[model samples]
Target: MGDRNGCSTPGGGGSALSVMAGAVIGAAGLAWWLLSEAERRRQQPRQPRSLRLSTLRTPVPAEVGTGTSSEPHERDLHDRVHELNQAIDDVRRQLESMNTQA
Candidate 1:
């Protein structure tokens, strides 16, 4: 009942429809991947930034009993502290660069 391509002969009681469907889907996926590769290759490479810093924010201290167990609040505090540390490091680097240049 099956042809060489594994598709059933017409009215031969096999999975001709499924075989054709699979072929169509495979072709579409291949075409998509090729197009994506071409587009990516066409884009120019990017240069790294000389300096980067996150925006400064005045941190509000956690309230004594506002539930320190809240996950989002803890995450926010952690992120804020990290940004502050990064800013401090940037300032130190700038100072060192200035001293070296002078």
Candidate 2:
């Protein structure tokens, strides 16, 4: 531990104090570097984005007749159309079942 220069040996009070001072300076340097890096990151310019427009069509009912018609008749027509579709589907399913059995 004694490198004879009349100075204190390694692991003595002076050496220990010197090592602690070195450690403190190192830590302070690391902290300053981190803060400067953060500042540099904040100063960087952001990229501008271009928004592309989408073309999508939505289906809406055509306005043909004005409101002079009976509401009950309109409802009856809608129900009849629905029932016809169901009947057609049932007939198709029965035909498919019969064909498979055959």
TM-score of each: 0.33, 0.35
lDDT of 1 by residue, 1-102 (tens): 348654455654446668888999999999999999888776523212222221134355565675654667789999999999999999999999999999
Clashing pairs in 2: none
lDDT of 2 by residue, 1-102 (tens): 356754566557787789999999999999999999998777654322111112123343455577544565799999999999999999999999999999
Among all windows of ten consecutive residues in candidate 1, which has the lowest summed lDDT? 46-55
Off by over 4 Å in 2: 1-11, 46-102
CA lDDT of every candidate: 0.73, 0.75
Candidate 2 global CA lDDT score: 0.75
Alpha-carbon runs more than 4 Å astray in model 1: 1-14, 46-79, 83-102
- Which is the leading candidate under lDDT? 2
